[model samples]
Target: MEESPAAARWRVPPAQTALKCAAAAVFAVLAALSDEPGGLLLAAVATLGSGGLALRDLLAPVRVAADPGAVTVVTGFAGHRTLTWPEVLDVGTDERRRFLSTTRLLEIRTDDDLYLFSAFDLGADVREVADELDRLRAGGPRS
Candidate 1:
């Protein structure tokens, strides 16, 4: 189906998805090559974990989508939660500092929940996403 011109979508980048898949493959190979039962178990667990994550990303790549009516966000594996524009109390950015590094996140606040999406999660700059969301919310031109 074709999305409306007012809609915006974001997802995990293909490169990151490929990296997860690659990690899963490497773990699978390790599992096949391991001689010790403990090593085999570890590799098997890693393989399953990474493989599941990769599959999830591949199947449900769109992490966030917003349109004139509402905003939908992936809440779990193949699951989504949508909040109408009226339910959205605020859209902004937050900074997280850990030691020498700082991470920016897009935050959406609703009546009962606060959703945060990182740049990696949205596959775009947090600031840019925030600006777009603001414009969309304000019924301004997307450009």
Candidate 2:
């Protein structure tokens, strides 16, 4: 049987998380090994601190199986943002970051709310994923 599109909604790619953890470990070691070493203990601390945040953000996505009635962006996560999709009204990119730089923003509108989501907090597949979100809000398939 085919899985429903709702069952295939966006979630962070698992390998991404593992890879981040591994990269952090590698960096901690390399940093600690440098001529001007960050110090083994300091590197370890840094790795743990950042790894925790990465893991948290990696798991912060709660809409992997279906789009909400509307999108809601809760920016005050103790560490990460929480997003609900059905309320999102528009998404756009701005070159304000620099002459060649752009930022993605998701503008949401609800019966009594408005908010925006930025690309800065997102990862590699941002364009494709954000496009899907756009289609979803427009009442269409992820295509």
Candidate 3:
């Protein structure tokens, strides 16, 4: 069967989400407790900034795809980066405990430059995606 264009993603880790929730809660309390307007303003800024980062992360996993010839990372831009089989030279395990099954990192050395893909920023299904990318790149995807 032909592959669908929709990018598949592993969901974000619960630990990360919990941490973000905690930070937001703390920041909210700080903002509320502040007696001076400046303190409140700072707290609000921190809360908003942190929330923005979290939102960016939530959206990133939805923008990636792996195929036999290449692993395409969609940047939601006019142009996207593609890592060919040959470009993907090695995989790295970051030894970080953030997600469930994704690799720590994937190191790619293309004809032109080197690229590193880290799953620490991804959700739950990264391991499956990585394995699929490896298989497809090695042996073309099943028809």
Candidate 4:
């Protein structure tokens, strides 16, 4: 038997989307019930805009899915970017230490540009993701 080429598919938690939708609904209802037009309008706009962004995230999440053919990058609403093994030039990590915490990001460099993927958004360690991507890019096993 042979394994399918489809490697991994990363997506944001659905709870995040649900929370955003709930917030939007709450704000809209509050605005409708409020007597103050200015505050109502402000609340309505903020909530709706936030909801739209969240919905977009749900629809098209930031994911890096690699297969035998190519690696696909979906950056919520930004569209898809595909890179073949040869096109995946390099994979690295970025770390930033703040006042009390640190942040890590996975960086992918190609022939023409560089892309950054956040571990937080992927719900995985940046190093792990980078390693897997590097392996796939090098024509190694998907596992």
Give me the candidate number with maximum TM-score: 1
Better of 1 and 3 by TM-score: 1
Better of 1 and 2 by TM-score: 1
Q: Which candidate number maximizes lDDT?
A: 1
Choose 1 or 4, whichever is better by lDDT. 1
Tens digit per residue, CA lDDT, model 4, 1-143: 11246476555556776777888888888878878989888888978887786777776665677766788777436578888877877889999999999989888788887878776456678798777777666678665
Which is superior by TM-score, 1 or 4?
1
Better of 2 and 4 by lDDT: 4
State residue 37's C-alpha deviation in candidate 2, in Å.
Answer: 9.6
Q: Which of candidates 3 and 4 is the stronger one according to TM-score?
A: 4
TM-score of each model, in listed order: 0.90, 0.51, 0.53, 0.78
RMSD of each: 2.3, 5.4, 6.0, 3.5
Task: Report the poorest 10 consecutive residues by lDDT, candidate 4.
Answer: 1-10
Location of the lowest summed lDDT over 10 successive residues in candidate 3 = 1-10
lDDT of each: 0.88, 0.51, 0.57, 0.74
Error of 2 at 104 (Å): 4.4
Ranking by lDDT: 1, 4, 3, 2
**How well is each residue in 13-38 modelled by candidate 3, as lDDT tens digits?**
65775677678778878999999999
Superposed Cα deviation of residue 1, candidate 1 (Å) = 17
